[model samples]
Target: MNQLSIFLAAGGGKGGEMQLLMMGAIILVFWLFMIRPQAKKAKQQKQFINDMKKGDRVVTIAGIHGTINKINDDGTLELQTSPGSYLKIERSAISLEWSQQINKAAATTVTPTK
Candidate 1:
């Protein structure tokens, strides 16, 4: 077992480099799968919020549905939920995917004549 012990001791010196490479690969994969997608989605959401204007239909992240009555310059918006009923919320409170899906379903429900 003397040769085996020498072989293991010699190989132990290279383990640090191998472990560092493995950790780097893991970090790269994690960024590609998790961090990258989350950043992209956040950018899209910010764009969607910025492009909004008065009279736009929207659904908040809290599931509150309303039409935008006014787009305030101070980073807030007034939403009209019902007749004479309104709620003021932040632009970031809107949900991009939910609003888009709800709008899509609405558009598909109404068929036009040829």
Candidate 2:
């Protein structure tokens, strides 16, 4: 009876260890799949925001399209939608590089050769 009890306790301890290992692995996978990519994206966004300069066209998160007229020392951007028409927006408001190449590609209409 004593030997049997000891064997059962050892088996239970191994099962507990395996459960702990599985939990750790799950946490690691969650970080890898979810947390890590988010961190990397945030870093990239920060870099893009910091690299903003005058004359660079950008699209805001709210879908406003404009040229960066000035960058404030406090991280706010002064954007001009048209001559003398400007909006002050936060650095995070900018969404993507509104490059001329992208605009040109979008403007070209393709017709299928039938």
Candidate 3:
């Protein structure tokens, strides 16, 4: 007999159901621990990209920092890195987490003028 038949014969038919249960549990755990969070993060990233507008400070995935000069209709943006210096980049290239961190730091680090 083949190894598959020998193994099933050894287990007396309970092994097949047990294997199915284990596979289902593994799929559930994988969805919970991996797929769910990734989908949520992707949704948040899409929302962030849609909310971007002119003059918002942002950091690209490649770590380029700039202010939004203009948002193009073709899924691109004009990023002003410095005075008279600009780079055109895709809207999806912005790093949502890094931009939030920098904006949060800037908001908290403001000083009052005397």
Candidate 4:
């Protein structure tokens, strides 16, 4: 009957709408929980690279430690390990900053005295 066909069509349309809504919600949740955090981390990395300056001590990704002697405009760093030792490294090779404040806080928390 014509009414039966109309009823089936309407039901199918409603199911399709629900499926679309569910897919959209899943994509939104994936972006929020996964993609957004990665984007934020990349932005932070860009800011850190831009803020680099001479005299800042840095640790390279290859586990080399040195003080920044000069910063080149083309994303290169001249590092001084000692009086006469120097090396050129790409800006991305530097990892997070090393700070004495973190060491002091960690030392205080692990005191042997009761």
Candidate 5:
């Protein structure tokens, strides 16, 4: 009765191959647009986390901002919120992009020539 019914009626011998090709195409496009980029971003994030060092300013996904005071051997970080005030947090909680953006913005906002 509908367009789908009409299409199904018309598609007899070649319909199975067409459906398989279309499904394969859909999967390819989905991986190209979605899965691949997400995996790449995850790899970059892991690299960023591994590269972090003491005295580096960073922000967490929870919106906490601090400076790295110490790198623990147990996959955790000691963050200094202020002088003599420290908080221990997991390394994975750090947000690489937010920290970089904030630090860059802070750097740009200050007029060095002044």
Candidate 6:
């Protein structure tokens, strides 16, 4: 036991530096797996919202489906749910994934006339 304690004490000087290196690695892994993807997604969402225009079909985070009738200057959208039914919602309420899925499906289902 005396020899084991002396061995451990002699090697203790490098342990703090190893711990700091491990901590840095953990932080790098966490940022790559968690923070980086979230920030990229937020940037994509912002771009999607900015690209909105009249007549673009979209789905809201609340699951409301509509076509944009008007782009308001105050960060809001005038959504037309039906021929005459309209709802005013914030631009950020649009779901990028849902809207893209819906639009992609619509594009593929269109039958071209000869």
Pick by TM-score: 5 or 6, better one: 6
lDDT of 5 by residue, 1-114 (tens): 698888887877598888999999999999999999999999999999999999899999999999999999999999999899999999999998899998999899989684
* Candidates arranged by TM-score, highest first: 6, 1, 3, 5, 2, 4
Report the lDDT tens digits of candidate 3 across residue range 1-114.
699988879897687888999999999999999999999999999999999999999999999999999999999999999999999999999999999998999998998889
TM-score of 4: 0.72
lDDT tens readout by residue for model 2, 7-88: 9987998899999999999999999999999999889788888777898878888888889999998879899999999999
Q: How does each model score on lDDT?
A: 0.94, 0.84, 0.96, 0.82, 0.94, 0.97
lDDT of 1 by residue, 35-88 (tens): 999999999999999899888889999999999999888899999999899999
Q: By TM-score, how accurate is candidate 5?
A: 0.86
TM-score of 6: 0.92
Candidate 4 local lDDT, 10-109, one digit each (tens): 7998899999999999999999999999999788777877887888767777878788899998889999988899999999987754423433556788
Question: Poorest 10 consecutive residues of model 4 by lDDT?
Answer: 96-105
- What lDDT would candidate 3 get against the real structure? 0.96
The candidate maximizing TM-score is 6
RMSD to the hidden true structure, all candidates: 1.8, 4.8, 3.4, 4.9, 4.3, 1.4
C-alpha TM-score for every candidate: 0.89, 0.77, 0.86, 0.72, 0.86, 0.92
Off by over 4 Å in 5: 1-11
Over 4 Å off in model 3, which ranges? 1-11, 112-114
lDDT at position 52, candidate 6:
95
